[model samples]
Target chain A: MELFSIILLLVMGVATIGSAILALTTKKTDVAILAAGAISLFASIFFLVLASPDVAMTEAAIGAGLSTFLFFVILRKTEQNAEK
Target chain B: MLLSIENIALASGILLILIGLLGALTNKNIIRMIVAFSIFDTGVNILIVTFGYMPGRTAPIIDGAKVTAQNIAQVAIDPVPQALVLTAIVIGFGVTALMLVFALKMHEKRKSLDINDYTDLKW
Candidate 1:
């Protein structure tokens, strides 16, 4: 079980790193926002794997849901203003 | 030396922090910087929770049947870090919202997203 857990953690770590790289390097602003949210979603999974279900839920709700929504809303507003 | 859960989380947290710092420092767009800050925030939260992880222990939840109050210390991982990270997650959301608002205002004022345009302190 421990080995299985370790393997899961390693896979998640690799995924988070890959997504972080994507968030940082992506040229599209919308893609970067989505990648940042993906990082949060992956992190919530990490918390669950570490035996912190409460933290995981919170991260998923606020970090992944609300923040990403807010970013998209703000981005839309900014783009609209720019187009005007 | 073992690739335990805590060790893996710690390493990932550190690497994520570095990735966030790199993005924050190098990105010139206001929204991108905000994204980097959000990533940095997650890394910090992960580190906090990882430090409190106890191997072979279940979650800190106590229902008096599975994890009694008496044996919770031995049977469960630390709850304090979970609480801290919980607060951090909400606060991070608030902060990201604030930063987005600020970025919006900046964009409205200058009509640009580049950090170079905001030279209020330029000599």
Candidate 2:
């Protein structure tokens, strides 16, 4: 079990760093937003692995779910304004 | 010796903070900077939880089976950071929402997403 958890931690750490880099380097706003959301989702999983389920749930709901939705809304509004 | 999970988590959290700082500092777009800030917030939350963790422990809930009153300290992880993180998560959400609103208002006023365009107040 310890071995499995260590492997999971390594994988999550890599994914978190990779997604963060993607969020940082992406030129497109939408892609960057998606990558940021992915970072939150992975962080929530990491929280669960670290024995914090409450924090994980909050991160999943607020960070991954609501924050992404809010970003999309703003992006759409900005694009609409640009088209006008 | 191989690094423990706690050390690995701590290192990763620090790396995340650095990545977010880089993105926040370099991004030209206001919305992208906000996204980077959220990433930084997540990194802080990870660090807080990592600090609260103990090896071979369970959740901090006292269900009376796995974790009883007598063995609570021995079996359960620290609950303080989890509570603090919960508040931080909500506050982070509120702050993000406020920032997005500000971004929209700025775009409305200037018709551009570039932070460079809003240097009217600069000396």
All models, DockQ values? 0.91, 0.87
Give all candidates' CA lDDT scores.
Answer: 0.92, 0.92
Which portions of model 1 show Cα errors greater than 4 Å? none
Candidate 2, B18: how far from true, in Å? 0.7
* lDDT minimum window of 10 residues, candidate 1 chain B: B1-10
Candidate 1, position B100, lDDT:
91
| DockQ of predicted candidate 1 | 0.91
Give the alpha carbon lDDT tens digit for every residue of B7-28 in model 1.
8899999999999999999999
Error of 1 at B51 (Å): 0.4
